[model samples]
Target: MDGFDNLSASEKAEATELQRMIAVEQQKAQFQAQVHSFTDVCWDKCVDTPGSKLDYRTETCLVSCVERFIDTTLSITNRFTQMVQKGTQ
Candidate 1:
């Protein structure tokens, strides 16, 4: 904050935007990691063998399981966000 105060308006704006961009990238990386984890878990649950191509049933199971996992994660995230907001208020 002390260093930020010495920055010119343009420099401050640029710095803020850079910080926002970095936050967005970090979020994207976290989401990618979640997706990877979801897929790995679903693959283990749905896949019996590593064939050249997945059969229809296995593919469907993987999709359904991943969707449910993402949905559950979003629901929990939303609940936690609400709780944090309520606490702050």
Candidate 2:
């Protein structure tokens, strides 16, 4: 690919915006994948069988399970970020 320096101002802005859009899309896709994985795992743990609708207890369990998954994900991510910062320093 050609050097970004050769791009005109408007072209540079357009490329930057496109890159931002791509990043947003990637984040969306990653979040969706994570949710799917979490749902599958929580389903196996909290669900006894497929029903027309979930019972209150099962519903609560699923919600808590998903929240726990989110909390763990955030905690791990924060730990990794901290480790990276420490390494850089």
Candidate 3:
């Protein structure tokens, strides 16, 4: 049987809303995983050694690395979108 078939109208609406919320949370978790992966890669690439504290130079480098990664991602995504649109025409 359809799962919602047993639910009242209000319950059905609530269930649908819950499903939407779950999807949104899943997207958020996936985004966080990507960010963590990026940070790990960037950290290894940018930091030469582990320090007891974050010095100004290392902090700047990490920030720059993340920013550049984001910028590159956006640039590539935009170009890909344009290419896809052209191909569809």
Candidate 4:
């Protein structure tokens, strides 16, 4: 690409907006990857395959699984922070 100094004002603005859109797309992709990973693990533990679309029981279980996973993460984070504060490895 030519240097930004050679670009017209509108071209520069377009480039900047394109860069922002790319960043947003990257963030969305990363979030999707995390969700897929989480779903895979949680499905293994909670899902038994779809039986005619999602049943309420399975839906509830999946919700609980995600909630508990996040709760576990938060608990571990707090504990690790306390350990660091106390200079404990």
Top candidate (TM-score): 2
Over 4 Å off, model 4: 1-3, 53-58, 70-89
Q: In model 3, which residue pairs have backbone atoms overlapping below 3 Å?
A: none
Residue pairs in clash, model 4? none
TM-score of each model, paired residue for residue: 0.87, 0.90, 0.69, 0.58
Which residue pairs clash within candidate 2?
Answer: none
Ranking by TM-score: 2, 1, 3, 4
Q: Give a tens-digit lDDT track for model 4, residues 1-89.
A: 65678889999999899999999999999878868977998888777876767788888888998888878878998999999989965
Model 2 TM-score, 2 decimals: 0.90
| lDDT of residue 66 for candidate 2 | 94
Candidate no. 3 TM-score: 0.69
Q: In order, what lDDT does every prediction score?
A: 0.93, 0.95, 0.91, 0.86
Candidate 4, residue 6: the lDDT equals 85
lDDT of 1 at 13: 94
Per-residue lDDT tens digits for candidate 2, residues 1-89, read 64679999999999989999999999999999998999899999999988999999999999999999999999999999999999999
Residue range 10-69, candidate 1, lDDT tens digits: 999999999999999999999899988997899889999989999999999998999999
